[model samples]
Target: MAELKNRQWLLAARPAGMIKESDYRWNETAVPPLKDGEVLLRNLAFSFDPTQRGWMSMDTYVPAIPLGAVMRAGAVSQVVESKKSGFAPGDLIQGMAGWEDYTVTDGRGMLGLQKLPPGTDPLLALSLLGITGLTAYFGVLDIGLPATGETFVVSGAAGATGSVAGMLAK
Candidate 1:
């Protein structure tokens, strides 16, 4: 609908350890229109956590985010407009829409707004119920192979996944 003039944070100089704000840069750029089978999403929210910190480190851990590249962050967005099948405008969803106002989603990983739980609490579904929930459903329990009533400990105890895992452990 509106022109895609968006701004975002990008990894600038690679960091040695615990990523600093200076390691990233704020940028303004124009997003292109979505082509056939593509939907343009207006980003609503994004997640910043430990892995992103790893990405900011040396290339051995993960590729560096070249100085001018837009920083990689997992995000959710609402469809402002769409030409793709299975997606309509105004749908709320979660996925990798990056950190920008408008993103051209190629019908890739777009979640229909109707499928989200009927509630207004963004944090519940966005961070907790969405990716974090999916991870909790599959990660800790799946990977750890906990038996019934096994004592499970979540490593990143302060984060979304750990919080959910801790609850599920009880």
Candidate 2:
């Protein structure tokens, strides 16, 4: 087979106040061969979230994206090669991936690799069917716990999470 190049956007520098195009640098490298227990993925879609800013600027739930490293983001991807059990080529999965054309994972990151159900919408898997939807579902049901007839108010009702939360509350 032909060689595959991995295109990436690396974190060039940390932002002082606001993030800019200068904060990232473009990169391309040969796709590495998969190791045992690792799976190769071709990124199909990425999820842009407000928390990624915090990830770029400082350590929050996760450490900051280091300078010269691939910028971190959530993505829906298709498995291209697998040395791992339970995953095979052509299977669609979602998890924490980087801003790159290809990714290699051992299925043990923060979100871990999850096989998307057949015919699942990739875009929705990144949003309403992924973390955003889960956050909204649990936040409202577990934390908020509004009873019948109680008015549920979502603060950021216009955002992905808020919009889903509002719908769940209805």
Candidate 3:
């Protein structure tokens, strides 16, 4: 517990237009001991998407992440320790673990602390095959519904969702 360091990026202030490093504060704290029904996650990779801006604003699908708190972001992590029945050590999980080296959860009130299939690539799971991929999939198939040969335009063309949607559309 005391040996483990939980490095985190905390939101220092809201962005005026574009985000900068000064907008966040980085620090490390000891990883607390896991309680019953909780699991300790060692984050491997983080997902950066356009939705992060919305999260910085006053409101969106979810409440804005409070100042001085860990910046909110999805991550692909491994269960380093667990006291929960549904999880075990070495299990790969995807969830909203924020911008931190480690997180602790009870598998509750999270995006979905889903376990990745054995041997699943963490990079793939965190990017094109993750939320961005799902947003593109639904946007193009459900919302756009373009027929063959129809031209579709993407707004944030270079972003995760836009890039993925473009590829899927093509």
Per lDDT, the best of the predicted structures is 2
User: What is the C-alpha lDDT profile of model 3 across 87-156, one tens digit per residue?
Assistant: 9899999888878888988877648698999988988987877898899999999998878988889887
**Candidate 2 off by > 4 Å:** none
The window of 10 residues in a row where model 1 has the poorest summed lDDT is 108-117
Q: For candidate 1, what is the lDDT?
A: 0.69
Better of 1 and 2 by TM-score: 2
Candidate 2 CA-lDDT value: 0.93
Best by TM-score: 2
In model 3, what lDDT does residue 74 have? Answer: 83
Model 3 bad stretches (over 4 Å): 1-3
What TM-score does each of the candidates earn?
A: 0.79, 0.96, 0.91
lDDT of each: 0.69, 0.93, 0.87
Model 2, residue 118: displacement in angstroms? Answer: 0.9
